[model samples]
Target: MRFLLFILICAGLILTAESCKKECHDRSNPDCENYDPCYGKQPLTADFETFEVSIFPDNWIPYSTDTLASSDVFFRAKEENVEYEWTVGSETITTRSFTRKNFPVGVRIPITLKVKRKTDFGCFPTDSVVAQTRNIFVIDGYENSKVAGYYQGYHTNNAADTFTVCIYIPEYSMNPPHEKTTISGLMNISTCADNKINVSGSESVGYKQYTFLSQDGFCHGAWGRVRVDSAFMGHIRIDYSYLKDLTDIKSQVDKTFLGKRIN
Candidate 1:
């Protein structure tokens, strides 16, 4: 009886050792059924570019469900024979490239690209899933100013109140034509497009409308007429008011400034 019990214990230990051997096999082992060829490697990358398409506010709403203006974005993949998954805002698409035409202004929108190679299991090393994101900005006609760059000038209301104005587009590479102005050095001022100004002129360099809110709670609204001949020059007469409430207007201060593009 003692000998039989010893044999049974030996058999159990051998079975346990065999199970451990199978479970301990690494991906490099060919005999292992779960071997992986693309272990510990990122074999793919997702990349794309963007372009902007601006439209008038009156004719912007083509669809009832659409949010903002439309943009023509061109996306491209670096690798061939791969599956693509794109997430633009709340929408997902499997196409390699498509024009996404619904985004809001004055905000940053995220565009994501996820990809993986689609090949035979053992034909080549399996590619790991690669995901990349590029934040985009969609601009209306006002934001898409051709005179988008740095400028140097001073406020004409007060001689001692010197300031530098920067009219720029954020994330210039991925978004459509739009501009954001920042008046720094003297006082910190930011662009405020709460109220749109209507102006009629040439699309390239004519009349551009803008609104600015300073740190001192003053809202400045004006239209700047830019001339692009030998140099980029513009003058603006802005009516500023201390905006305790944006909905209601009261006391106002009028100021003027002339700016030249240094960059």
Candidate 2:
């Protein structure tokens, strides 16, 4: 009876050892209590948020000598207690939160956030995570300026015909002796070069006013208004009158244009 009892006890010990071996070896199984399911996986989480602020406000006038033209992007990490490294373009920053001043405009930017934490798992040693944020576009301050971009729209008289216009205003100064602004367009409007334009408006009106005349010995004059909406959509309206070279008579144009900012 004693020998039989010893044989049974040895069989029970072997069965218990086999069960434990099966459970522990299946480390990926969630039901296995003795083994970690997250073994060999990245154990750290990394995430971040970004906010952009335009350096120039609605009433801001851009001067040629004015230095600040780019926007600012603020970055913040959602997690704490881990080492942080931020990669922006060719530069790198090591901080929990930071503000990037004078960020470039009119292009998509990819910002990367990397974090690492000390781990108890010797095989892994350190838990590392990488997160990426992209499609960051900083609006150019010059976008808000009048006579700065290509515009397209239709006149009320002829909706079927598209009128495209381009305006170029040299970087402006609030003080006098400003550089010349120019306008060129299709559909009855001739290129008016060397326009001596003075832009004036109040904040309550929410638009820049440009009353200009051609200095190139032609009777080209206009009262124009330009507004940049919140979505960066540019709007322009010109009441133009010029002496036609063919008829030697004055012609007029009253139209509004909508366009996107290229700069």
Candidate 3:
């Protein structure tokens, strides 16, 4: 009977060792049947880019969604055939690239990326995205004296909307004063919409009635927003950081805004 007990003990030891490893026999390669995903996972980032703390934001929610695309202002990641999900400011998409046409121009938005990866046999787990890029559109003369100048009135196209614009003299893009500008502004109830200051980051601000030169002479008109029903009067707001500062882009764009002149 002692010998019989010894044989049973050896059998139990063999079974325990087998459970600890994977076998090529199962389709899912799980130690047990129907085992869940991530029972054991290959280290992520091996087949993808390494994580950099400085590139991603600390808080994830209200993230602005975007993708890896190639353009003058955007840097596109070259990875393909790999699954990924992008979450931008409460929305999710499944692409790896985007263009200026994809989002509202000149707005700064937060973004997030999730890579689809195999965490178990026949299963994939979504991993955090691993890249970053600019979140606002850039244009020539975007911060020019015309569009950035001040005005007082309502969008002529829409009677209900009122506006008061103020543009300071074109700032010195250079230390010695190259007559450049920056992108920043505030709302007021008084008259101060006639300065020639240039600002950066956004081109959404404008005045069309007076043919401002900062507009690159294109008559985008005196519309705070390109859309007639867009932000009105002191209602236009900007994300100060989203402004871009390039020394070129001084040309006419396709959009136009019509509004009354402020007193």
Candidate 4:
């Protein structure tokens, strides 16, 4: 009878041990393939909330958003519990659009976006992104002047040979200068008729100067000259001036009884 009681006690102990083992396994195993319970809980991403800024008319400045869209600036989420902050280097940014107000022509403006995210465990993750727009206000080869016109001129010696020049000014800049302004553009001396000049070059406007050379033969003549008036209202009056020769003029009038020619 004692042996029988011992055997039953042993069986009960074995069953209890097996049940405890099964419970431990069930509690520890994760549902997903990796079986890491803390995987999603940890913060894993850091990124910019926006990648680009939009400018609007009347000095409207628009900022980027975190949503996913073709137009929306996209940033990869680094980790969970993220926070975003934006900064514009220049105050000239007016309105919802990134209108660089009072921004100097040929200046490069850098805009920054900062992102902060935290994990479920209270750890913070931070990251930042930057976008740069160079000479955004001034178009290439176009400088501070606000004048636009077609000017033609030639070297003083040649009347038949001619050259054409174009000047472009920014739409902004109240009271833009009319004189003492050097307008630069590309010129094809060989192919004047084609006139395939690039107003804007590889560099942004205000960053570099552009120059066009007149044909070699035209350089020696009274080619051309154009001058802008003194007014500061973006109005440029272009005048084409050429050289003239007088062949029938006499140097001296009748010198009485002298060897001088008569007028």
Candidate 5:
């Protein structure tokens, strides 16, 4: 009886070991059905492989939404076992929107996005992307100058020509003490039709009419010069303003800047 009991205990132990072995077998290994040498010793593949990030509108604006259009910007993480972080060097941004009371002018803020992935073995690798945002002010020069600039080009059917407005700053000047200078401001235009003006052939066409201010801070001023480009048409109808300001500077751009399509 003792010998029989010992034999039964040994059989139970052998069966338990075999059952565990079968349960943990590697299906990829043909010999795993009976004996898997690689069982419990399998290699691991890193879960994280790739990721992507992006910013919306691809441009930054410094004025209030009522005065200027706002854009949405964001970044995304696409890998497993990965973590993400974002930082802006100057202004505080919330989910891609600037939240500061005032954006510092003439400053470039670096936006950084970082991604880190961890391997099964506890090894970590990192990736990063960086961008920048510039601050600028908008000034309205057309309202200050009463001259209406007309749009003239081959794409008139789809394009409407009107006075271009820009932001102005006293600091901008072509020469001398560079006293108070007038720059362009937020763009608002008056079509020719709105002003009771006639549209002729490839000549000149107008759509709307709007009042502009003067250089002396007056409400009504006539434009003095007119300028047109692939992107905008400037009319210096108001003495306080000019047809257009320098395009190389950000402060010179207004709503009319969007009208010009540069090839």
Candidate 6:
């Protein structure tokens, strides 16, 4: 009876050893695919909460970047009365949202969000998931702004070519955008137009007040800030002291002139 009991015990031990072989396999072994380190571990993921900001510049500004622009960004949780700490640069504020304005244009800032259970709510002193904050940028690059399209500038009713202004924005992929606030500045003044214009002797561009145009909307073309008089509300008028004589039948341009912004 003793011998039989010993054999039975040995058989039980063999079965137990076989069951633990998978768990005890070498972690470095390439063939050990049965081992899973995260089988019983819970997962933690970081997230960023999207909040609406009242001060973000969604459209292009017609003037300076110093103008006040405010927006709010914050994080929220499903728990009631949850507390949050917002961090940006070296500053940390204990609020659910933050508002900022006058940030330097072209500067990118990173923000972080840390959350904890509020004392008012029944919660433990444990830290919750901290999410990464969104990066921000100020309104910049008005000089190289995107103002691409065709326009007809008529300063006179007799002839369209006499005061016709053709605006063309280059392909953004091949060439960088150009900036100018004047008719001559936006054109290639190096070459003359069919001997009609002296490239070196064209008129200059002038700036005027947009309000004087008495128009409802505003347009800031590559020619810079446009100045439209009340009489030319729908169009731009320039009083050229002399004809540009720069004739381009291909483009239907008559004269080239220098101009200044009235504002």
lDDT of 5 at 182: 33
TM-score computed on alpha carbons, candidate 1? 0.34
Which candidate gets the maximum TM-score versus the true structure? 1
Off by over 4 Å in 3: 14-29, 35-71, 81-137, 140-177, 180-263
Q: What are the per-residue Cα lDDT tens digits for candidate 6 across 1-263?
A: 99999999999999897777755666445446555543443322233443323332222122311111222333442233446666767787776544543446566667566666423222322335445565654424322322222235433434443333432222224344432222332333333232121111111211122111101111111122233333443444333222133242243233322222221
lDDT of 3 by residue, 60-162 (tens): 1111213211112232334565565665567666765542234343445454555554443343444333444334322223243133444444433344665
User: Least lDDT summed over 10 consecutive residues: which range in candidate 6?
Assistant: 210-219
Instruction: Please give the distance, in angstroms, between residue 206's alpha carbon in candidate 6 and its true position after superposition.
Output: 28
lDDT of 1 at 203: 22
Q: How would you encode candidate 2's per-residue C-alpha lDDT over 1-263 as one tens digit per residue?
A: 99999999999999998888676755666766556755766546666766433332442332211122245656777778888988888989989888788667666777788887776475564555556554565545443444466777666556677756666666547788755555556234333333333322321111233344455444343444444453343555555444444344445544555544444
> Over 4 Å off in model 1, which ranges?
1-43, 54-72, 119-126, 140-146, 149-260
Note the clash tally of each candidate.
4, 0, 41, 25, 46, 22
Candidate 5, position 1, lDDT:
100
For lDDT, candidate 4 versus 5, the one ahead is: 4
Query: Candidate 1: deviation at residue 249, Å?
Result: 54
lDDT of 4 by residue, 1-263 (tens): 99999999999999998876655633236633335554344333323333322221111122233211112222332333445443555333222222223333344434444444333343323223223232123333344322344445433444455555455434434474432222332233342334433222111211111122123323111122222332332223332211122222242111001011111
lDDT (Cα, 0-100) at 75 in candidate 4: 30
**Higher-ranked by lDDT: 1 or 2:** 2
Count clashing residue pairs in model 5: 46
Give the TM-score ranking, best first: 1, 2, 6, 5, 4, 3
Candidate 1 per-residue lDDT, tens place, 1-263, comes to 99999999999999998897788658776667677666554456787655333232221112111112234444555556678898876788887767765456657778788987654455344546778887766456434554455556666666575556555433333454433344333223343333322222212221233333343333343323232222323443333333344455563434455555566
Q: Which is the better candidate, 5 or 6, if ranked by lDDT?
A: 6
- Pick the winner on TM-score between candidates 3 and 6: 6
Worst 10 residues of 5 by lDDT: 199-208
